[model samples]
Target chain A: MNKIEVKGLYKAYSDKGRRINGYDECRLPEGSTVLHDINLSIKRRSFTCFVGPSGCGKSTLLRIMAGFEHPTKGWVFIDGMPVNGPSPRHIFVFQEDGLLPWMTTRENVALGVRDIKDSDERRRRIIEYIELVGLKGFEDHYPHELSGGMRRRAEVARALITNPDILFMDEPFGALDFLTRLQMREEMINVHMMFDTTILFITHDIDEAIQLGDQIVILSERPTNLRADIPLAFPHPRDFTKGGLAALRRDIYFQMGIHTAL
Target chain B: MGEDGGERKNGFMKGALSKCRQADRILPALTVVVIIALWEWVVRIFSISPGVLPPPSRVAAALWGLAKSGVLFDYTVASLFRVTWGYFLAVAAAVPIGMFLGLWPLGRAVFNPIIQFLRPISPLAWIPLAILWLGIGDKPAVFLIFLAVFFPMLVCVMGSVAGIKVTYFRIAQNFGLTGYRLYTKVVLPAALPEIVVGLRITLGTAWLVIVAAEMIAVKSGLGYLIVDARNSLRMDRVIGGMVVIGIIGLALDRIIRRLETLPSVRWKRMQR
Candidate 1:
């Protein structure tokens, strides 16, 4: 069975004025049709990258796949069970350091595994992930105290500590600088190798889509449908500066509606 | 971690000291000092009636006199207890109900109209009804205070939940949290900041209501003390009571301010 399956999804958000009666709807108040007629399947343990233009519904599709959002008209299945809400066994990391502002780096990393009942094992795993992200001696620091790169690293530690079967990341490195972005990419590749979790990542950067994806899915404009599903052959720690990777970057540029700006 | 993070938790105090030395920060405080100085001079220069417009010094003297008698302390404690009981009761009832109303559309729709219709009615207006229901003493005063505090704070909490960043909610849901976990994990923490703000404002309003109610409802609190002094024409005690109320209100507000200190501010020099 595919680790994740999206079958003929249709979702629309109706944004209307606030009610005098003070009811809050889960859907957006401003009508936005984010996803329309999306059908796809992600094989187990594959590194899949979702690339598209702004507001093309890549993020929305990722949310639906993880069951954070419900489709207005379709069904999603993960591991043969219908996707109803968040699957605890699946982990998601987003662009912002979703680290609780109050929690120390350690507490945030330890969040998922803390309830495991075995204190020592949980602590050891938390420390291991923290150290894996190359954040040593900074476990006590809060999100605001860390630099942007460091905060993202802490997020990485938090996500990976859970040992999830599927990892969903939305624009994870889109906020970092060039040098830091490269470093984060390398760390992600290493973490993927270590855990072998099926990762579905969304990114606007074509180079990022090229460097990390085993198969890159390019989405069309919104109410979005598929444009292309191209596979990247380059293995992890793929050097973007290398000529082979650079060529793939050129192809993704055309796909994103930006014609080889580089 | 910087040494200052550990040693200088007194950011406001340190700021004041630094400003005093730099002269820029202290400038604002200095202006207030100057205004007080000028006001003191003017009142004394004009020889205003000790009753009608007592000088700052006379108010200070009256404060000292009350401190010595310890009767001022007694009145102060009564006021504090009344406000505290009412404020806590309002919060205990309002927070969870507000959370429920904010989370579910049905509850909000059902309760919201009722809340809105009643919101316009002042707590003072409810005094007579409160007296009738709870019978003319402490209960009426407490009920009035509760009415004044509960609705505004419940609205603030609803606003806080409404304003929660979409990403925060999404992240929590992605972890399979629903039911009680959803409330304890995502909604509560995200709404904390705005809820604290509501609690602070409610406490201030509660203080006012308690004092006002005590003057008529109950007999021994600061509000009654003020009325008794006024009727007896002991203006010094009245001024003392007013000052005591102001100081207590200021102290309560400062406590809330500390509690509501921003997440970033409390985090490793995130504010400074």
Candidate 2:
């Protein structure tokens, strides 16, 4: 069953009788337009990735899905209800950790759970998630003491502790080292597997798009209409060093406008 | 110790010891000792009158006399109370006002010009008006202190709030914070350091303004004591009161600086 659905999606910003970023000019001749009459459904517990370059409005779409920004003329339904704003049930992990400097790792992970009924239950879940993120001994440490990679781990751990039906990650591993990025992708996939969550991950990396996405949605330059949604034939626990993964990487690279070294 | 280990350890210790000495040790304090020595020598050489300029020893004697009389404590406590009450009033009023101004464009538009216009007027200038409006005693004294402290504090809170990085806001927004929760939980805490800095500035301002207020508006503070001693021709008591005021001001600023460096706030600073 589709856990998340988008239909006839349109997002435009207007102020002082001027359209935001000249998006009105990008609309085609038909009823369809840029971000053009989008229709797509995300399956339950599927790892979906959106790939596009900078200024492709990928982040804007992600923000809309997260309910930070409202769609101008379309609808996004979460669990069969239209999204008004970010609900507690749908957790989001941003590219930057955004961990409160005032909070400890344990507290940062447990911040959104203030509305949770049971304290003991929340504490146990927070601890479990913290341990899952490999930050067991550092639970009491603040965000300042953390390295960049550890801060991101804390963010992911915090987002997961809420036990959302869908985890929205906007370029979560975009700022990490290449090796750390690979490790983070595997960790995130493992997390999804362990928790059985639906993920809507957005990034510009084709290698990353191929690696973790079960459904890779490619977006055009701006007024980002859905370019392609390719399903990964590569199974879980896919080996990066293996030749099969390299070919998949090549296909996505050529498709996304990068030339081969040869 | 092993051959290389001993040398490395010795070098490390030397570096650590020197840093501590430079940062904290008593060499800097030697400047104070030298100044006092020079002052004493100059006074003795000039044969300065005890009535006109009491030597440090005579002033110290006056401090001892005042301590024994229990009069010094009463004046110090009274002055402390006025400063405390007035400083808190300024903070309580200014912080929310500053936050409103900082957070909302409309609030900034309304209040910014008024505050800027009033802020330039010195706390000392308000003395006569404060006495006339509040009419003597604690009211006038507290009013002057408030006048001195309010602007610095308001600016500090506004500046601190303004100083928050745009990244932090975007990050918080991404995590689903909006409305009041965003201001209280995110913006306030993020801007806390600047608010602290303002509080320190106002603490000193309160101390200063109270001295002026006490002298002209009220009659029982360190400033008044100095005035009374001048009339009585007890130069030693006047010098003693001045010393007490200086010491308290220095101490309060140090305490404030210490509070600002508390571990959590320091950690927050490092993150920024």
Compared with the true structure, all predictions reach lDDT values of 0.79, 0.80
Query: Fraction of reference contacts reproduced per prediction?
Result: 0.46, 0.27
Tell me the deviation in Å of residue B133 in model 2: 2.0
User: Which segments of candidate 2 are over 4 A away from where they belong?
Assistant: A8-40, A239-245, B1-23, B48-53, B162-184, B232-235
Q: Distance (Å) between predicted and true CA of A1, model 1?
A: 4.3
**Per-residue lDDT of candidate 2, residues B64-176 (tens digit):** 99989998999999999999999999999989888877766567778888889999999888877877788979998888888888887887888677657654565566456
lDDT of 2 at B65: 93
* Docking band of candidate 2: acceptable
State in Å the error of residue A86, model 1.
1.6
